[model samples]
Target: MKAKVLVTLKTGVLDPQGKAVQHALSSLGFAGVDDVRQGKLIELDLAETDPAKARDSVEAMCRALLANTVIENYSIDLVD
Candidate 1:
């Protein structure tokens, strides 16, 4: 099984890195972009065959280490 975890800052949280990227884009003449946010993509290859189990494991991973639950939100995508 394969799992993809997308971790992003929660809405309303200040994102300095995102702001920096936005500033850079505007400086580069990309004025159409009103905002920029950055996140991380984590791809995991798992030995578990059961979709349910794999999802459970990934969810645990997210809660334990993959994401900062207080300030970040995460979504999971599973593939065969």
Candidate 2:
């Protein structure tokens, strides 16, 4: 099985790095770039074949290490 995890900051959280990138893009003449939010995508290859089990494992991985749930949220997509 394969899984893709997307981790992103929650809304209303200040994202300084994203803001900096937004500013840089505007300065480079990329007009209408209103806002930017940074996030992480993690791809995992697993040995399990059960979709439910794989999803549980991936969710655990995200909660245990991949994301800081205090300021971030994560979603997992499983693929064969």
Candidate 3:
């Protein structure tokens, strides 16, 4: 099984890295680019076969290590 995790900062939190990227884009002649937010993608390979179980395990992974629940939110997807 394959699992994908997307980790992103909470909406109200300040994102300095994202702001830097936004500024760089505009400087490079990418006009009309209003907002930019940066996030992380993590892909995991698992031996578990059941989608339900795989999702549960990955969710646990996120809570334990993959994501910082205080300032970040995570979304998970499972694929065969």
TM-score of each prediction = 0.97, 0.96, 0.96
Q: What is candidate 3's lDDT per residue for 36-68, written digit by digit as tens?
A: 999999999999999998999999999999999
C-alpha RMSD values across all candidates: 0.6, 0.6, 0.6
Best candidate according to lDDT: 1
Q: What lDDT score belongs to each candidate, Candidate 1 first?
A: 0.96, 0.95, 0.95
Q: Tally clashes: model 2.
A: 0
Tens digit per residue, CA lDDT, model 2, 1-80: 99999999999999999999999999999999889999999999999999999999998999999999999999999998
- Misplaced by over 4 Å in model 1 are none
Q: Lowest-lDDT window of 10 residues in candidate 2?
A: 26-35
